[model samples]
Target: MVEEVERRKKEILKAIIHEHIFTAEPVGSRTLAKSYELGVSSATIRNEMSDLEELGYLEQPYTSAGRIPSDKAYRFYVDTLINDRENLNLELIKLLNNFNYERQGIQQIMSNMAKMLSSVTRYTSVVSEPQMKKSRIKQIQLIPVEGKRILIVLITNTGIVHNKIVKLKQDLNPRQLGYLNEYLFNNLKDKRIKGINNLVLQELEKRLIKRLDLSQEIIELVYKGLEMVSKEDDFKIYLGGTSYILEQPEFNDLDNLKKVLNILDHEEMLKDLLVTIPNKELEVMIGHENKIEEMKKCSLVFASYTVGDMASGKIGVIGPTRMEYSRVIASVNTVAELMGKIISELSG
Candidate 1:
């Protein structure tokens, strides 16, 4: 008898969560009994709902007898009820596979990811550019543009490309430029971007200082060019579908809508929120669980995508706490997984 009662309650709770997710309205026992085959009458479902309310899984809002899933209920649904029932959106996968991963750079890939995720999930998406300190240099090139100006191109193992223009104190002829380029390629190959500080540069300069062919001015210019490549700001946050949040009922209130908008506009805060995820697993932060005041009313579902095991970037969907958790979680996970593969291929 106890087992049967527990099964009935679970069904009732699941029905309420589903109903609320769709309509964004409180669910009543009559509705559940009519819409879902709970195999129990309205009175029985009402009793079960009361039991659930007492158990803190459901709450009666605005004196309405109908109940809505509380945060606890969402926690339960995400942790237990969702299980493995969610399936990846095959169409989304197909669309991603069709993308020209070879031609696009890291920034383009991240932008496309944000756009694709927002379009698919109908939620605002934010993606961070891969952190550079964690990546190693893959290749470097110094192309002479004119007399004293050279274009320095640096590629990281994680597929990020940095370009800088440096003006040298002296001009180099074809053979000298060729030798300098080859020398730089041979020395700085496979070095970490963060590890190339002044001390390291000085050490390299000292080793080559005695070489009659390479002038000190040229060596200093090369050092300056490398510094420029490694000196870019940490990373940027790419956001897409900001307008999607306006469609959610939870943001119907003007105050609530503004708060979310402000949070999104604050790039550093958003990046901090994403970077706090401890691992690559799918994470769900619902309601007050989010530490940021503006985001306390929202829910975030995000996952990290790795770039060849060196660094990881995050992609997330932000929506109201009454989000379709099952669908959002599945979509985020699918995108994160595919993104990791695409980034790996591009970087490799």
Candidate 2:
């Protein structure tokens, strides 16, 4: 069983982690005594460090050298010692870019958000596309341009619009187009994409097949296009500042650097780094706690954002284990709240 750390030991542990995070080097007792106002001699601080090491909070990397904080030490520091992070808010807001959300699509907004996070935090940023589970069909329009060509616009209640152009073998007359529009609106309007199944598919097919005056081939093509736009993207992960993490001193090793880069290069694996829980606000995963083998040497800070009650998305920063917890945490919180508010307003 692990024993509780005393007040002085906790203070010493916090100091070591702070020094190591700043300099990326092993923290020795003499340096702590000289720099920090610990009110103790070097010998006393050294003794406390020894006890802290024995208790598994600190580890020595070399023989007769300074010690570094272990994963346990980092976890303790993040959970207990973090202070007011308001000083960095102004800088973060500027980097986040106060723009017109109503004019931008979700894709552009998310891409900009990823870049913003990386620029501010100097770490790799990953932002997931907003989930659209409850987004229902708002309206559908078919506009004719020229010979045998038409434009289809599918708008979702969540403010997502999809446009497609198709060439039909036969031109659709205005009367036929009006009838088809009414039929589509009566049957599919306000229907959730998730609820579209085989039963619904059979009914749509059966009714369309019975319409002998309409072109079956054109309806088939239209169905294909509509289905494509209605579904959600398969794990779309927007990545930014991927090379920034490589610049960290901890990723100096070539082998370790390659492993981390591989994870970032692939979306299937990167998607696992950001998972959104509906109501939970924020999460910080340190070292092995992240549960991904290639990412065990890194840390991930995640914040969940939602589009009103329809769907939720995620944004995060990936950096070395010795991360600036206070700044990163505050930044993620700020961005998540700002993003959720803008998206909700647009959707509403």
Candidate 3:
């Protein structure tokens, strides 16, 4: 009997979610019976709705009204109703084709795509640009310029090239800089060195200790090159339509608004939370499903975007659980797919 009631409870919850998604209104028992074609009486649905309310799936905003889904209920609905990538391939192709399909830089692609997503979904959209932290180094060049300065250029296999200038103890000639460049490439080529900073300098020092002439200057140049790389390796998050939330009644509370803004202000946390490397099509972390207090009141929809079939980028949407899952999830999936495509074309 408990299992039977539980199944019917899910059925009622599904009906409520569908109705609420379309109407954006709390679902009363009578409305559910008439609109959902549930083949159940309003009295029966009301009783089951009451039971579901007890189970923490539904809530009544006021004494005299119908039930709205709690965050818990929204989680269940997203987990069940949104697992499959429905009509995603066809819609994704359509949306991608609508774009010029040219090789726009990843940043431009994300910004425009985020705008499009925000326009369609009317929710806050965040697109993380393709980060090359995990990519391996392809080559390093030390070019001798004038006035005791040498330019260190590091190129990654993924077509990202970064350069920095370091003042040398002695202004080396082009021949010496060329030798150093070749040596660094011989040692560091194909190495994943985005995280390698001063520690890498120390290691290179130990390796080149025998060649006292090359050790100090090479390490200094490498240090400066790494500083440039670190600066470039930082994530870029483009957030569109934060103001859209102000229009929603739920964010009317000043305190809640502050919390949301704080979360948005810490763009690094957003990158860290959403840009993890996971083989997931869509990631939905519900209220309290997140690790932070600010996010406890909301939900995040994230998906990883790959660059050139190798490197991973991230794109997502953030909004209340009442967010239209089918539509927003579709938009997120489509944007993530395009982010990957754009990065692949640009990087290739």
Q: By lDDT, who's the top model here?
A: 1
Candidate 1 deviates by what RMSD? 3.8
Model 3 residue 2 CA deviation in Å: 6.7
Q: Which stretches of candidate 2 lie over 4 Å from their true place?
A: 1-5, 83-87, 96-103, 139-155, 161-182, 197-235, 275-279
Estimate, for each residue in 71-144, the C-alpha lDDT of model 3 and write its tens digit: 88988998775554564445445656788746665457678888777766777888765565666677787777
Candidate 2: what lDDT? 0.78
Could you tally the backbone clashes for each prediction?
0, 0, 0
**Taking the tens digit of each residue's C-alpha lDDT, what string does model 1 give over 1-348?**
999999888889999999998999999988998899889999999999999999999988889879888888888888888853376667677777777767887789889989999988889998877776667888888888876898988888877788888888777788877766777788888988778888989988887767537678878887887886776345778898999998998888999999889878888777667765655567888887888788878888988777776546788899987888877888888888788888888777
| lDDT at residue 206 of model 2 (Cα atoms) | 71
Error of 2 at 131 (Å): 1.5
RMSD of 3: 3.7
Better structure of 2 and 3 per TM-score:
3
Better of 1 and 2 by TM-score: 1
Tens-digit lDDT track of model 2 for 1-348:
134337778788889998998899999988999999988889988999999899899999888659998888888888988862644666677766666566788778888888888888889988886654456777888788797888878776656666778788898888878877778877888888678665886688679768737767888777766666665553367888998977899899988899899989888667655542223677888888877788888888888877765446788889998888888888888887777887778766
> Model 3, 68: alpha-carbon shift in Å?
1.4
